[model samples]
Target: MHTLSNAPLRTVVWSTGGVGSIAIDAIARRPDLELAGVWVHSPEKVGRDAGELAGGEPLGVTATDDADALIALQPDCVVYAASGPDRDGGAVPDYLRLLAAGINVVSTSSTSLVYPPAYYSPDWRDQLQEAATSGLASFYASGIFPGFGSDQLALLLTTQSKKIDVITVTEIALNDHYPVADVMMDGMGFGRPLDFEPMLKTPGFIEMAWKAPIHLIADGLGVEVTEVRGTLDRRVTHRDIEVAFGTIPAGTCGAVRTRAAGVVNGREAVVVEHIIRMARDVGPDWPTSEFDATYRVDVSGDPDIHCAMNLGAAEGHGAGRAAMAATAMRVVNAVPYVVAAPAGLLSSLDMPNTLPRYAFE
Candidate 1:
C-alpha cells in the first residue's frame, strides 16, 4: 500500500458526460481529494468551467480536450467515465494510457474490470497488468448494478450463512425519465421492433458486461464457474408511450430482462439479472420497484436470505439522474483506495471495506 500524504489527492475527471458530470461534483465535494482537471469530448464543452459542466457553482478549472495536458499535470488519480457502445474496446486504451502514466484509475466505464481476473480477455488483462507494473499504478472499475449492488452486497450476505445454494442479484429499473436517447434507442433498442437486435441484446454482450459480478460472487463462495451464459427477454408495449428519450410507438420493444449466470457444477450458482422498463406498467409480471430503481439480492441456501435496495432522489430530481449519481459516486469514492493499492488491477476482494468517508458535512 502506498503511504498517504497530508494533502488531498490531485484528481482529474476524464469526461463530462452524465456520469462524468456527477463525478466532477463528487470529487469537488471530497475534502481529501482535489479536482485538478476536467476533460471534455465535445467541442462546445471544451473551455467551459468544470462547475458549469457539472451544473454547479463556478469552479476555476476549465474543461479541455487535450489529454496530454491533463496527463502532464500528473494527477494522482482520474475518474474515468467516458463510455459508449463499445465499452471495453473504447475504454481499455484510455485506461492503459492512464495507468501506464502512473495515474491510478477509478472508472465507471469498462465495468468488466470490476474483477479483472474474471474478464474474458487474458491478453488485455496482461497488458493492463504490465502497464500498471511499469508505472506503479492501480486500476479499479465499478458501478451500481454490476458493482456494489450485486457482487459486493451478495458476498456480504454470504458471510451470515453456514451453507449456500444459489446467489442472485437483480436490478429492476424504470427508465422513462432517463433522457439519454442514444442509449435508449440505439444501444438498447427500446423503441425498435421486437425482432430487432440491439447492441445490448447481442450475443455475449450481457455475459461480457455482467459476468464479472457472477464470477466474483462464485469466487467469494469458494466455487468455480464452469461457464458464463446470458439470456435476454424483451417486452413490447401495447400502446405508444412517452419517454425522456422519445416516443416508444405501440408494438415496439419497451422492456428488457437479461439474466447472466455463472454455471457451477452444471448449475447456475451465481446470477446477475436486470429488469429495465421504459414504464413501470410495461412488465406487470416482472419484479417491481417502489422507487425508480431497486436492487435485490437473494441467497437461496440453508438459511434463505433476501434483501432489496430501493434508490431514488428528492421530489424534483428524476430517479434516472439519481441512479447515475450513485453510479458515478461509486467510482469516485474508490479513488483513495485505488490510489493506495499495490500497482495492478484490484477487485473488491483485494481491498478493505470502502466506507463513505467525510460525507456528513
Candidate 2:
C-alpha cells in the first residue's frame, strides 16, 4: 500500500465533459487535493484553462490533448470521467495505460469495472490486475448507480435486517435534462423509434452493465448468485417534448425500463432496475418518484427495510448538473482511500466510508 502524507495529493482531471468538469471544480476547491493537470480529447479544448472550462474561473492550469505528458507528471491519482458505453474497445485501453504508468485511477467510465471480476473475463481481469501489480498502482471504477446507488448504499441499508430474502435497488430518473446525446439517444434508445433496438436492449447488455452491483451486494451479504437475467421495456411519448439534448418527437421512444436480476437458489435474490424517461408522463404506470432523480432500495426479509434517496438540482444548477456533480464526487471523494489502498483493483467494499472533505466549510 502507498502511504500518503499530510500534504495535498497531486491529481489530474482526465476529461472535460459533464462529470469530468465537475471533478475538476471539486479538486481545485478542496484543500487536501491539488489540481496538477487537465487532459482533453478534443482539439478545440486544447490550450484552454481548466478553471475556465470547469467553473468559468482561471486556475492557471491549462488543458492539453497530450495523454503522455499528463502520465509523465506522475500525479498521485487520476480521476477519469470519460464517457463511452462500449467498454470493450473504448475506455479499457485508456485505463490500462494509466495504471501501467504507475498512476492510481478512480473512474466512472466503465460500470462493469465497479466490480471487475463479476462481469469481466479472466483474461481481462488478469490483465488489469497484472498492470496494477507491475506499476504498483491501484484502480477503482465506480459511479452513481453501480458505485453508490446499488452496491454501496443498498448494501449499507441491508445491515439492519435480521433475516435476508431479496434486495432490490431502483434508479428512477428523468433523462430529458441530461445533455449527452449519444447516451440518451443511441445508447438508451430515447428519442429513437419504438421499434429500434438500442445497445442497452441487446442480449447480455444489461447483465453486463449491472452484474457488478448485483455481485457486489451478494458477496457483501455472504451469498452466491446462481444466474443472471435481464429484461427491457420502452414507452413512447404522447407529444413532442424539448430536452437538453434535443427534441423528442411525438410517438417516439421516450422512456425505457431495464432490469438485471441475480437469481440465487432458484429465486431472484438481488435486482438492479433502471426507470429512465425523457418525459415525466411517458411512464406514469411504472414506478414513479416525486424527485426528478431518485434511488430506492427495498429489502424483503424478516425486518423489512425500505429507503429512498432523492437528488435534484441545487440552488444554481440544473438537474443534469446536480446528477453529474454527485457522480463525480462519488469517485473524487474516494481518491484518498484509493491512493492509500493496496496496488490492485479496489471496490467500495474494500475501502472505508469515503465522506466529503471540506464540505461543511
Query: Which candidate number has the best TM-score?
Result: 2
TM-score of each predicted structure versus truth: 0.96, 0.96
- Regions of model 1 farther than 4 Å from truth: 313-318
lDDT (Cα, tens digit) per residue for candidate 1, span 224-316:
999889998989999999888789999998899999888998888888899999877787898887678789999899799999987785233
> Compared to the true structure, candidate 1 yields what TM-score?
0.96
Lowest lDDT block of 10, candidate 1: 313-322
Looking at model 2, the pairs that clash are none
Q: Report residue 343 deviation for candidate 1 (angstroms).
A: 0.5
- Candidate 2, residues 1-361: lDDT per residue as tens digits? 4788988999999889889999998898899999999999889999999999886699999999898999999999999888765655677687789888889999988778888669567677788889998989999888888779988889888879899788999998876777778888889998898888889987898888788999999889988898889999999999998998889999899889999999988999899999998767898999986667788999999799999988875322355566677899999999998999999998888989888889876
